[model samples]
Target: MALYKQLALGAGLAALLSTAAHADLSGKVIGFSQIGSESGWRAAETSVTKAEAEKRGVDLKFADAQQKQENQIKAIRGFIAQGVDAILVAPVVSTGWDEVLTEAKEASIPVVLLDRGIDASQDLYLTSVASDQVKEGRVAGEWLVKTVGDKPCNVVELQGTVGSSPAINRKQGFEEGIAGHANITLTRSQTGDFTRAKGKEVMEGFLKAEGGGKSICAVYAHNDDMAVGAIQAIKDAGLKPGSDILVVSIDAVPDIFAAMAAGEANATVELTPNMAGPAFDALDAFLNGGTVPEKFIITESKLYTPADNPQGEYEARKGLGY
Candidate 1:
């Protein structure tokens, strides 16, 4: 009888908590600091964030930092000054946020990290929502491992912006995934700045250096956009992307799906842009007396291959502005 009473009380309290959370966030103001729309993924993220705020009836104040750390810091201070209810920052660079985050902590305005994390004390922010970058790389690596099997594979990697967390973690993850694969090796690697033009230029140099692209077996780009650019480079050198040289990358953007459908690319790991949906959920829960969630809330890192209906995937993402 005592156990039953405890269970009934617990249920009641849970329902009460749910009600409070739902009530606390209606029409609340949220400030979001985004790393500028440097890529299709970032643009989609910004769009999705706005849609989420509208759906929840929350007033959202957005700032784009133009891919600079100082601009991001300035935006954060501006949000704090405006007395916003909560702050969401997808930090441009990881290290320089301790002081600004400290100010937010002192003001008692809970700050949540969206899509990217800052290098700071955990207590400074409410929680972080992001994709496991290393895992994304590992997924790409694993696919190539399975595809190549026992064949000797020489992979040339096109890394993202140097020193960015995604570039760092993703490279580490791919290395970890291919650790024991003796038949596969990374021969040459360079930074593409996560841009198509740079990816193409770097790949052109790699082709010239590697016996007119014959010495290379595969291309491992940090993102699908780069892989698409690399495909053009391979074709210019009289090599077929899927047959003569395999192409694998992270971020399943719509262009990548088009590449896959046309047989110019092999596989990609997805990095969804719906980061704000989870961020808002965590913010609401915390504002209504719920404990801060697990520090790291990882987003999905789904893999898409040509065999999984590339045309359908392309069509789905086309309207999403990717």
Candidate 2:
């Protein structure tokens, strides 16, 4: 996340608030509720956010929700009790956020969402910092369509946890990308829970069910870690991954770039872990000058192909907590 991700309070009550002219955030304490280290990108996000907070002289109080809405709710309440300047959350799910957000609002605390969004009203939070998940899926889908040409292809999908915003929106984008291409059919679809181990296990099942990868042309995963696992599964099934079955997914983690350099994976859409940058900027502007920032701040969803210098990308992100 950077200054480029956010807009100035586009709509809603956030737009009506005036920005303060003076900015001084030193010695201010802030509470952050992370969605846990569920993926490589999430772990990196935690690392980056902490580093950014230190640079800004902001005391960052962190809480890991372990992917549970109840845990997140409890953490928010605790932050409210502490009366921190603001609260940041990377939601585990979309629903069940109204009550907690309302509580934050009542406390006069600005709540900022990171990475994923919740079903609660936009008025409840200051803003959300995230990437365009739907666009990520569309990019992967478009790449596969171009690589396969007019050849009739059957695709097997490894989706993230069921009902998650990324999973649902990514699937929608994929469908939109290949809408007119009847030759490309998503054959067997299943959830891999967005983990390397589960991705491998589910991919094995997909190989067995698809007649040993004979009918499947490509594999699309919701995250790069899953795609990496699926690649290993393809190899263990006595098949070449890059030539036998194409690989493409989202979340441009360091491992995914390594896979691309080795030609095991085809492409990945980046979900940058630097979301804290924009969040802190908006918070600073709001507190210093009463500036009402944009309700939604979107980060980049960059597509990295093998030709985009995979080895270079890998070296660049490896030390960044990926």
Candidate 3:
């Protein structure tokens, strides 16, 4: 009888160990759908996210959406089909996300938005970790207003992707900043797809339409990539950039700091690219059944000018590792 009791106890212990091993979440898989490498910041985001997941022992399944909304949707669905524990998305556009997010919710998997946001119901996703894009634009606009004073500045704007949240909110906030200043007018505005090539093409058109840069006082771009492109356009047309045409933009990329140090660009709003750390922190909590606030995270940003663009700081802030 004592021998039988010992055998039963050993069996129970073995079953408990098996259960614990099955429930161990250290090797859980996470799905990450990234918008394609559009700029320096985007590339940094991708690198950091992968590194963080690997460090945390997460099997990260990644997909590149190539800057297309449809591609992101397909990737999200694929993650769901594969039964990943959680999913992360940096949406290419704000709208058209509710349907796929609903699918994720139905699958009992949590979703986290990275740099960009979606215009879905709050309950559909876990949380968003991103900078306040509208505020970034407002900061840039305020700097322009103070610097240009009451000087009737005719502005040429370089917008981002057509339907992205950053482009829309940045334009809205900039318009608000210049609202009471009747002398500040946006003479020409066009989408540059947030790329250097497109920004240059659109700026060339603006220069021609304004009769070789005499009519424009400043250029406000949604991101530094576009601003850099516009600066090249100004130089190619035989005009000095900062002196001939003032430039203000968002995303304080390393290249933009170099431009500021060279006096080619005026100001930029800093959009830090280290979003993955905070995202994984939040995900860990949610997956562990901890209660997460609906709007759990937000990244802070600041404005950078030539005076503040120190050499060491510029090098350290180049790519998003923080």
Candidate 4:
């Protein structure tokens, strides 16, 4: 009876604290600038963000940048003009953000970065919530190196948008991962703009240039959407994707897991869509309690393959607004 009484009291106190925290953010107006629905993971992030805000009773003003930096800048300025309490941005690109972020700071609106980080100074925003993107690429590359062993493998890379942080960092990290392995060579590389259509187009050209996909041993895409497109390109070229050319990418979206279940793809690194949860928590603390959070909050990056039960993953993530 004594233990039960203590447990009940602890539960009651925890509930009170949770309710107080929720009340601090209730009815607060927040502006979110998303980088458009470019991929499945992106759509999931937006959905989760909205659900989180609704749960917290926050009035969320959502903006889609449509993959343009100028549009994002315009939206931020609009949010500032509206005098929103806080602003969240998933920058379309890392550069070209100093001016608009400066404007937000001047207006006394706390800014939080979600998913991607900017190249500007650390003081420009309250904090950044993102995954270790370089490590994501390194994981994919390390998997390939282990899979192929000392075999001479010619790799073709499907890069993301030219100037995005994921594109730049993932490329550099993959290069570093495969540095000492002379047997693995990245022969051709090109930007797919992080789009499925462009990924297929670029891959088609790569197949033709590399002797109809005969010389290619692997294909590394910056994202799973591009990998899925590349898989189709390989199939159309009369080559098996996972068998002939090992397919590896990032952002373990549902469709990518489906591809892995069907033996179309090989591996992927997870970039979770719950970045908004941490971002909101940080905002709540900073806005209500004057508590300053860490400058960078990095989420986990786990590698997934067919052995990890791809079908189960596919089912679990199918309804996540992806």
Q: Identify the candidate with maximal TM-score.
A: 1
Per-residue alpha-carbon lDDT of model 4 for 1-322, expressed as tens digits? 0110000000111122244345468899999998888655677778877877887899999999888999999999999999999999988777989999999999999999987767999998999887777877888899999999999999999998887667887888788878899999999999997778889999999999999999999999988888999999999999999999999998787999999999999998877777777788899999989999999887666778999899988997798777
Tell me how far the alpha carbon of residue 16 in candidate 1 is from the true structure, in angstroms, after superposition: 26
Query: For residues 1-322, what per-residue lDDT tens digits would candidate 1 score against the true structure?
Result: 0110000000111122233334356789999998887666677678877877876778999999887889888998999999999999987766978999999999999998877667799999989887777888887889889999999999999998887667787799899888899999999999997778889999999999999999899999987777888999999999999889999998777899998999999888877777777788888888876767889888767777889899987887677655
> Candidate 4: lDDT over CA atoms?
0.83
lDDT (C-alpha, whole model) for all candidates: 0.80, 0.81, 0.77, 0.83
Candidate 3 structure quality by residue, lDDT tens digits, 1-322? 0110000000111122233222223588989998877655667667766766776788999999987888999999999999999998888777998899999999999898886667789999999887676777777888889999989899999998877667888899789878899889998999998777888999999999999998889999987888999999999988989988999988776788888888999888776665666677777777776868457476655777888843544686554531
Runs with alpha carbons beyond 4 Å of true place in candidate 3 = 1-29, 38-40, 54-59, 65-85, 92-108, 119-121, 161-165, 205-215, 284-289, 310-314, 317-322
Compared with the true structure, what per-residue lDDT tens digits does model 2 show for residues 168-206? 878898888788999999998999878889899999999
Better of 1 and 3 by lDDT: 1
In order of listing, the candidates' clash counts read: 0, 10, 0, 0
The 10 consecutive residues of candidate 3 with the worst lDDT sum are: 1-10
In model 1, the clashing pairs are none
Whichever of 2 and 3 has more TM-score, that candidate is 2
